[model samples]
Target: MSAAALLSPSAPLPYSGAITDVAGIEVGHHTDPRRPTGSTVVIARDGAVAGVDVRGAAPGTRETDLLAPGNFVQQVHAILLAGGSAWGLAAADGVVRWLEERGVGLDVRFGRLPIVPGAVLFDLPMGDARIRPDAASGYAACDAASTAAPAEGNVGAGAGALVGKLFGVPHAMKGGIGTASVKVGGVTVGALIACNPLGDVVHPDTGELLAGARTDDGTALRDTRRSLLRGDVPRPLLAGTNTTIGVIATDAVLTKVQAQRLATVAHDGLARAINPVHTMSDGDTLFTLATGRVPLGEEAPGMTVLSVMAAEVAAQAVVRAVLAARAVTTAELAIPAARDWPGRRAAA
Candidate 1:
């Protein structure tokens, strides 16, 4: 579908331009001041049917297995996305604690045990590796949760995100978080992505490079696909150092199995906007959450429609990520944002 068709609101209904447009969902972020790394949390206070799909080979996640269709757990209280690689997983503990304090989670014999699933991306290369998101960071994010549109770019899990590293860090651009939502009849679907892919971000409809590896002179986009086609091999990046993780949510009612299917098909959006997604060196993952507010039967046609909308919103969210990103420079390295790139300025 064309970008306009994918992004344009359906007739008679308008979108809130954020994932929080979905009822019963809230978003929050905690950016560490020590360096460019932080955490983002998506909370479903009353709990929502959830499913996850981990496409990258080197994924680092928590409680994902419990989200399986056959698993006894049917819902999740929150989903956490953070930067710090594996160590960032510790942040989920704080989310669990915050939810438990609020009496949210599956009731057991002793007390409520919140179910918080999460994924992480590597940003240690940007600055101080020692300073990463921890339990406190997660709690702070939850404390800041709000229904209003959360700030995008250079915050939350997207802080310190670097893209177009196929040629190495020096040739990369800054990446960040972005959110978008769309409405279809009574159903509304939204996506929030923290884009840090190993490949380039491109316009889904036009296929123009938005951000990626820069030329040797660092003055223009290198066009990763063309460079590879011309036999320009990429430098070896560390396994699990790159990823694009996000959450897709809707107010439509859906079964656990259907939610999983939605998560699977949503990867199409990633493929549309990201070149060479789900690579061995990347840990791409996506989660689906259904608020069960709108009644849409678990029939083939209803699922088909929701699936299409899911992918469209996901792709749009990816594009917004790079566009909203701002430049970030450390003492050791400087990464430009797509909006500030010389090629983009020259084109404008």
Candidate 2:
């Protein structure tokens, strides 16, 4: 997916430009300058929330099983996002400790729900080698959660993101946090993603590819599919190499089960946006949250259309992620001649 000319943009929002869902859904991030790593979370009203889904082969997920249908937590005190790869699971401990200090989680007979659902992506090995995320960092991330709007593009867990590194970290694009929202039928369906896909991201409507793996032809820029078609690719195993994890935040009221179902449907949004997605090399996952704030009138025409519109928002987000990405320090993916990427800054 080579960057194309500033082709035409995708279709505009089908509804009036106003996000009616996810009221007071706050976000926060803690960046440890010691390394190019961090964490993020979408805070619900008072952190009392629900629902999640795990759809990645090599996912380092948390609280997913607890989010099951039969048994669940009424309110989720907090959500944690962090770096550290699978080992970063330690970060959850920080969240637990933080929440416990504040007295949150399930009030089960044996104990509480401890329902601090979370997700992670691959940024290690390719990120700042000297600086690694740890428990303290995780606590800081969760402690910082508030009405502060989250930062996008190369921050948080995505601070160290590098794309198109099929063969290695070199010849990869700079991918990080990206977000796009749509308001339909007086309801808002917004998407936030930390893009680190193995495949190339493309412009859905214009059909002009945005960003992909590159060759080390002095420019260090090459087309992902074309190179693979030519039989010039990387090794077979690439863990934590490709994944774009995210969650669709909505104020639409849906049961925990219903929210999980929406998460499954939301993956379709990813499929329509990214090329060669959901590969074994990719740990692609999506989590949906129905805050039950927007008194959505059942599957009213407004909310139903919101679902479809969410798909479009997700696709556009992938495009934005590619453009927001910067050049990688990885020697292999570096392009001596290439300046800034094309079709960039064509944003709203």
The digit string of per-residue lDDT tens for model 2 on 12-122 reads 222222111356566666776765567766656355345565655777777777667677455565566556666555667776776666766656676544456777777
Clashes of 1: 0
Worst 10 residues of 2 by lDDT: 11-20
Expressed as tens digits, the lDDT of each residue in 16-102 for candidate 1 is 378898988999999999899999999999999999999998898999999999999999999999999999999999999999999
Judging by TM-score against the true structure, name the best candidate.
Answer: 1
lDDT of each: 0.88, 0.62
Looking at model 1, which ten-residue stretch has the lowest summed lDDT?
5-14
- Candidate 1 wrong stretches, greater than 4 Å: 1-16, 297-301, 345-348
